[model samples]
Target: MTSEETEEVVETTTDSSTGAARITAAPYMPGKTFTNMFEKYATDGLPDVFDISFFGNISGSTIAQIRSTMRYFDLIDDQYVPTDLMKELVGTDEETRKGLLKMMVEEKYPDALGLSQNATSGQLAKVFNERGLTGATVDKAISFYLHMLDYLSIPYSSHFKKRRPSSNGGARRRAAKKAAEPTPPPVHTPVKPKVSTEEEQKAAYVQTLLDLAKKDGADADLQDRIFDRIEKALGIGGGPAAPTTTGGGTTDSP
Candidate 1:
């Protein structure tokens, strides 16, 4: 959890859970912005020194998603250098690209590839659910698979084809219920002085959310529903009433 009044920043992936240090797993998240970078790499050329500078003005979170997607697809080496797979993706013919993607789907996401074209979103989720995924965590993996299939012109369950609007249906109901039930007065929270670097603080905030999302995924949703809970809990107001879900946030992609 991030403190609105806090001034100190804790560096690195320290475990605040149960006092034991946690070993990490290979990163494999994909987010909405990942495709943008993957596409940009094909056009802009992945610089030899791959780092923040490689993606221009995008946020650090965006870069993290992009890197995670690359790693997930085995497109980049541990050092962030483009692998032969990625180079081939960038330069291959359309048919070869399809073959390469199919190979990846078979090897890395056999569960996703096995799904029937008419499967429902709930069924799609069940595939990940059985693997212990939940929330934006599941969204990341699914987003990557979906985008890859889209790029390959592969058929998938039409259930997952719809975007974020109708899903906001739940959001609207929650917003209304919250509006009708609110009565407590706001508790005035004391302000604390800033003592951390702006960028570092931003990174810390994002890392906290990412860490939380990851833990559950290891059972996830990203924006809208997930963020709505975060916003209400934080009492950060978008307006007098909750705002309707709008726009896309992040999704897993490569």
Candidate 2:
């Protein structure tokens, strides 16, 4: 071969080898900051040429692969892929940065898509209990889902209903009825009758004895004799002057 032809062929071969060894970096994820770069790329818009081959020659298969990767990682899904730009915009950490990429790759190629990658309603309580997680964890997962939905700007009606508590229907009905019933009123005590004092009765008895002694006579001698007789009969006079009476015989003051 001629020297010129040999040189040209050698250069050509070198260029081809260099091209084969070339490795491109991945592009920023799509749908960041409400910018639809994936759509634009798929529709033949060249935003920038660097690492463009990683997102190469967009097609249905490529889109599906991207979506699958995002979903598997629990970061993005078919409806959304948060861009690295968005992460930068939010100023998150390196862990999150690496995590986002890793998630995207996993979603692209999931081994078990049927299992609970993201928490679902029916699977939430079961998975939570299995993992020894709390209801708060499940609530956080739901909140995450809602945040993603909002980020996607997906419209949902406020009137949307959720599943009722899972328990016996009859038991639930009975509980509802019991809760609705009115409570009974409290009972009150009745008043009692009034009673007389013992001191009053004693005073009346003493007064009756005094009145009887006064009616004995107006004369002092008669009064004294009547008082003495009454006192003797009642065994109230003291010492030797007191009278004694027994069933066997009559007795006088000693």
Predicted structure with the largest TM-score when compared to the true one: 1
Number of the top-ranking candidate, with lDDT as the measure: 1
Q: Please list the residue runs of candidate 2 whose C-alpha ends up more than 4 Å from where it truly belongs after superposition.
A: 1-120, 149-254
Error of 2 at 245 (Å): 98
Ten residues in sequence with the least summed lDDT for candidate 1: 3-12
> lDDT tens string, model 1, 12-90?
2336877743222222345344544546667778677456667689666656656655666777766778888888877
Residue range 195-254, candidate 2, lDDT tens digits: 554444434444544675677445777667656655644558752333333445325421
Q: How far does residue 247 in candidate 1 sit from its true spot (Å)?
A: 65
Between which residue pairs do clashes occur in model 2? Answer: 68-107, 68-108, 69-104, 69-107, 69-108, 72-107
Error of 1 at 79 (Å): 1.2
Candidate 1 positional error at 53, Å: 2.6
Following a full C-alpha superposition, what root-mean-square deviation does model 2 have from the true structure? 24.5
